[model samples]
Target: MEKFKTKIAIVSSLTAVMILAGTASAYAAVPAASKGQATEISAGAKADKKTASPEEQVYNLVTKLQPGEMIAYYIPDKKINLTDRILFSGKGYVLTDYDAYTAKAAQMNAPSLEIPETYPKDYKFKSGVLYLKEPDESSELYKKLDKQLRAEAAKGGKEFYTIPVEDGTGEASGAALTFVKGSVEISLYASHVKPPKPMEGTPVPFSNPDEKTETMVIGGIKCTYTTAPKLKSRLSWTDTSGSVNYSIFADNAKADVLRFAKAIIEPEAK
Candidate 1:
C-alpha cells in the first residue's frame, strides 16, 4: 500500500509540472505576436511617409516669378531688336524660346549658315547660337577668346569674350560672345545686347516636390541652361548684393550671358 501511494504522488507532481510549463509557453506566445504586430505597423507607417504624390512634387518646384521677371521667346525676325527682355528662337516647325539666335539666322534671307562639318553631332542651333557638342579649344569661339581666357584661367575667374558684330555700314551691331574655361567652352550666343533676368530655382521648373522632373525644350533641342539659387527681383536692375546663377544653352554662350547681364544693368521695358 505504501509503495502504491508514493507512485501516485510522483505521477501527480509530473502532471502539475507539465501543466505549468504549458501555461508559460502560451503566455510567451502572446507577447511574441504583439511584438510582430507592432513591427508591422511601424514598417507600414514608414512606407506611407516615403511615397509622395505627383502634385506635391510639382508644387515644390514651381514658384511665382519675382517682380520684373518675364519669360522670353526667341524671335527670328532680324528687324526685332533683341534687347534684355527677349531671348531664344525656334526650328522652322517649333516656336520655342531656346534657339533664339539660330532660328533667327535660319529665318534670314542670308545664305544658309553652314555649321562647320567638323562640329560635333550634338551641337545644334538654338536662339541663333551654335551649340557645340564638346566645349573645347576646337570650338571657333574658344579660339577667338583663347588669350583672354588664359589670363582669366590663371586667376580662377570665369573667362568671357564679347565680339561686336558690325553691319556693312560699320555701326555698332549685334554681338557674338563666348564663355570659356581652360580647354572647355562653356556657352555661346549672338544678340544685340544681352539676355534678360533668369527665373529662379533649378532649370527643371517644379512647384511640387513629388512632381516628375521634365526638361525644357527649345526648338527640338533640350535647353542646357540652369538658373542660380537666387534670381533677380527685377529684370531691369542688377542684383549687386546677391550672387546670380546663369546657364547658357546658346551657341555663343557668352552672348546669352551678356543678355542677362545687360538686362540687369539696363532699364526695364515699359
Candidate 2:
C-alpha cells in the first residue's frame, strides 16, 4: 500500500506544483480563523480602512470566496514536511479505466474545466486522483501538521500557516489525470479558478536558474512551458477565457507535450 501511495504521490506532485503556482486567487476566499493553532490569524485582515496592503488585500479576498472553491496559499518559513500539508480536501477517487475516470471527473463540483479524452496511442490511462484528502487525526500526517502548526503558532505574532485549517468543507477541490507509457507517467490538472495577484512577499515560481521557462501561443491559447533539471518538462496555461487553467507534464519532447495540450483545448484538432 505504501508503494502504491508513493507512485500516486509521484504522479500527483507535478500537477500539485502547478496548482500551487496558479490558485492564488482562490486563497482570497479562505478565512484565517479556521483550522490549525494560529488564533492571531489576521495577516490579511483590514487595517483601519486605509489602503489594503498586498497581504491585507489577499486576506480580504478570502472572506469573499465561495465554498469548494479551488484555492492555494503561501506560508513562508514553514518547518513542516511537504507531505504533511493538506493541499485541499474532499473524497478521493483513483480509477484506471478511461470511461470511468472521465465519468468521475464530470461528477465533481469543481469549475467546468475540460478533461482530455485523447492521448498518445501508446500511453494508457493509468489512474486519476481527484483530491489529496485530509489525513485522519490518528494518522502520522495529521500528527505532524498538528505539532508543526502549534510550534509555529507558539512563536507568537500573526501566523500565516502552511497547513490549511479548512478541509473537507467545500466541494471537491481539484483533480489530476494521469497516463502511463511503459515506465513514464504524464499528468494534467485543470480548474476554473485563476491565480490571485501576489502578496507583498509572494515568491515567484520557476525562479531557479536551472529552470528554463517560456510562453507560446498554442491554438490561440497562450501557454507557459518550463523545463528543469531532473524534473519533467511541463506546459501550463489558462484558457482564453482566463477562467479555466491547465498544466500538462511529460518527459517527452515539447512538441509532444504541446500536442497533448492541443488535444485537450482543441479536441477536434486531435
Q: Highest lDDT: give the candidate number.
A: 2
Put down candidate 1 lDDT per residue, 1-270, tens digits, no spaces.
244223322222211121121122132211122210111111111255763322222111111111111111212222332231222111111112335534544444222222323333333432222211111334453343344323433454221111111111111112122333344343322223224345444455437343332344332323333333232111111123222222333222434334444332333211
Clashing pairs in 2: 24-196, 25-196, 28-61, 28-62, 29-62, 29-65, 30-62, 35-165
| TM per prediction | 0.16, 0.52
| Native-to-model Cα distance after best TM-score fit, residue 6 in candidate 1, in Å | 96
The ten-residue window of minimal lDDT in model 1 covers: 35-44
Residue 167, candidate 1: how far off, in angstroms?
12
Error of 2 at 39 (Å): 16
Off by over 4 Å in 2: 1-91, 111-118, 132-167, 195-206, 268-270
